[model samples]
Target: MSTTEQAVLFSCAQETQVGILSLPAEQAQVGVVIAVGGPQYRAGSHRQFVLLARRLATAGYAVLRFDYRGMGDSSGSARDFLDASPDIAAAINTLHEHAPEIRSTVIWGLCDAASAALLYLQDTKDTRVTGLCLLNPWVRSETSLARTQVKHYYIQRVMQRTFWTKLLSGQVAWGALKGLARNIRLSKAASPSRGAGDLPFQQRMANAWTDFDGRILLLLSGNDYTAKEFLEYADADTAWSKALKQARLERHDLANADHTFSNRLAQTTVENLTLDWLATTSNAIK
Candidate 1:
């Protein structure tokens, strides 16, 4: 474990200040901007990210981990998840401003946050983003949802959607399973929204990644349900294979880890692997 600095507040978009843990070194050569998962924001919940940031900082890299807008101590609505791209972009801009000497900037994200980063980079034209470190990134398409857990969790999601849809439909009646079933059916039958969901971002990201002149390290956990889903999709999609082949992206699989690396040993392994990759890539570039 390395020395870690205390948390600080940084202003992002429109007077919204996010809670950030800044780990700085006297001769930092690079800076990493990290975003945690959606449901996680408490300092305790992000101990792994904090530990990694401190360790990386000790290794001559400045690291910034901030709570996304509307989560944790940040000033914003929870709905910010719907448009978190700006949050990431704002964090990147703030990092560069705070540390102008940082020659390289890498964005690291887990799960949905990783998906947000992909979309953010695609939409923002002048960002200084140099590379990406995605951990079990969410890249599921409509078809991919079919393979998802259709039990309690899915049923709950269906019920929530039903409640909202019925409220909007002016139907005052509500039956738990019945309403949920109706909503699921409606959702399945509804036409897909154009220019929305993960497709546009996936297409743009796949294209950008293929032509990107920078390096990308994709880390996947063998036991991660999301990773399994992605693998299924990848195995079925030739475009994904072609894109990865053309991009020359690097992939690493942690055979014994879960999506969050809940196990201490697994988390440590992930941290070490990430640090090693950073050091190797940094030296190679130099």
Candidate 2:
């Protein structure tokens, strides 16, 4: 069957409107909503997301690729990570309303967006989602630490510090050293911790997956930095890996693919594998 492609806008929430590219097939059994990665608004329009959406649509699945609020053509402010969950929920709701006949709804997310979708599923308990496709999800505990490293490496020298006792004691040199020490301590404190907020983003994501009744597909790349990060944070005995194995989720690791599947052959391989997986899983569910 031929695929019909269209550009449309749908409200993600009460006042938020998202830009979407829809691929409609003649006889689609499921609908997929894609969530692209990047915490910043500018990165949402990366070529990988668009290419994957079109490829899946052409392969007979109805696909909707949209920008999260505040990114691309979507309505919202920039730097709104906390709001990503609601944005995804809104997109899923919109898909269901737009394609009521499609019984299965699959959510495809990459990097941080994948984590956001998991959080949404956990909070809403929306059972309409029949499958989840994660592309190099970013679920690492050291995300905060990495951010701190960047700041320290690039901008630490420019910051100024105040010495509290220097004004009182008139010991200028000692006070200066004390001020420097205090600044160091403050920076250390501000650095991301390994607590709940510091927990690997993926482990937090596992909470939702543990309860999901649908199928899951994890696509990893041996050369991808995110995959390397996963190895660093994931324990050998962790529940996340165990659950994935037990669930029999299709796991594919492209030896040469980068995080974004920048290589043309790698990207094509991913496309083909994903389409095949969807076809097989869809048939089994039917």
Candidate 3:
């Protein structure tokens, strides 16, 4: 199907925000809302979102990629990723209003934005969110970060012959090793508090994952440490493991891709995977 793309202006908490909406020629009941990560606008790094939106639209799905307040063309005081719920909600409302056929919505997000989407779902329990496509979800906490480093980085380094050669030959800097040790210790000691509100962001993410009943598609980049850390986090936390092990989750790893899947081959791989998943999911639900 042919696609039509248009610029959109919407209000969130009295602040005007900008978005680009891509509408399919053939009407569809499902729409995708792309919630971008911090330090990125809707266009995405390397115009990924623009390309993805067009591709999805051409495949008969409506897509909306928008700027959160304080990012891109949107207006508001600078806010962190955790504070983007209002902006996301506003974008969804705009997409639905413009295309009333969008009865089912899938939120597609990357990195921190993926985490933010989970947070929003936990808070609102919005039924419109029928699915989530999360790529390299950011579940960063000091403890999880530390554990990931120790297991993936440090352990790998310890086994490398080149690392030992440098260390024993005095070619490695002592200060660097000391800093690593200090960080490892600090991260190990920094566990999340047990209290509800005081809980760490990772716990909050896990809570959202548990509460959300929507279908989920998780894409992991093999070269991205952040994605690896999420896997490690699942192993470290019993709650995370319990929820994930028994959930209706679909996961895929693009071994050749980096964090953003910048290369042409990797980028195409992501797009195809996403389109295929959406097609299959839509069929299943219908």
Candidate 4:
């Protein structure tokens, strides 16, 4: 299928949001709205979003990659993904308006953006979102971060023979030991029960995830700490796990990929996986 890209500016709660809508010659009933995370804009880290939008559009699905309030060319004070529901909603609305052929939308996001997408869909109870494609979702907390560092970073390094070799050779960084000690303390004091569902932002996502009766795809980057942290939390608690059980859910891991899937091969893998998932899990597609 052929696709064309259009720049879209839409209003959301008095702020002007900017987005690029990639429309196929014949659009699928289900479109994808990508949420940008952190300081990254609509182009994504290494233009991942731009390339992804074009690829998905080429596969016959409409895709919208946008910048929230303050980021990119959008106007307003700078805001993080935690407070981005309005932006997400606005993007979805744009898709529906510009592409009337689109009957449902999927929120595709990575890192904190994934967290924001879940929070938005749950808090707004927006009926238009029929699916979620979450990649390495951000489920960080002081405790979780501490515990992850202690377990995955510190413990693993300590057990390594090279660590002992460096220690004996006086090449070890003592400052790291101090940091490890602090993280260990936090880990011990931190409880797995004190995860996302307990905080307002994650709470919204948790509520929505628990009650969301839609299709979901959980993508994991095996080499990322953030991805490991999410798994640790899920293994310790039932909040996200139980909800996932009730939904039409699938999970995949790119064992050699980084957080942003920066490598071209990794990016292409994600592109293909997403298109395949959208095709099979589409609620609006017969």
Task: Give the per-residue lDDT of model 3 (tens digit) for 1-286.
Answer: 7789999999999999999999998887899999999799989999999999999999989899999888899999778778888888999999998899876999999999999898888767889998899999998877778888887788778788998789889998777578679668955674566675666767777888888887888899999998988888787787788867755788889987999999998889889988988987788667
Q: Where does the lowest 10-residue lDDT sum fall in candidate 4?
A: 190-199
lDDT at 190 for candidate 3?
A: 43
- What do the candidate models score in CA lDDT, each in turn? 0.68, 0.67, 0.87, 0.86
TM-score-superior candidate, 2 or 3? 3
Q: Point out where model 2 deviates above 4 Å.
A: 40-46, 79-82, 143-201
* Runs with alpha carbons beyond 4 Å of true place in candidate 4: 168-170, 190-200
TM-score (C-alpha) between model 3 and the true structure: 0.94
lDDT of model 3 at position 102: 78
Worst 10 residues of 3 by lDDT: 190-199
- What is residue 45's positional error in candidate 1, in angstroms? 3.6
Residue 76 miss distance in model 3 (angstroms): 1.4
Compose the digit string of candidate 1's lDDT tens values, residues 229-249.
666555555555675565446
Instruction: Please identify which of the two predictions, 2 or 4, would achieve the higher lDDT against the true structure.
Output: 4
Q: Write the per-residue lDDT of candidate 4 for residues 1-286, one digit (tens) a residue.
A: 7888989999988999999999999857878999999998999999999999999888888899999998999999999877899899889989999988877789999999999988897679898888899999998877778889988889999999999899778899777788999998887663434444555455457778888877888899989999998887666556766765664788899999999999998999999899888988663356
TM-score of each: 0.76, 0.75, 0.94, 0.92
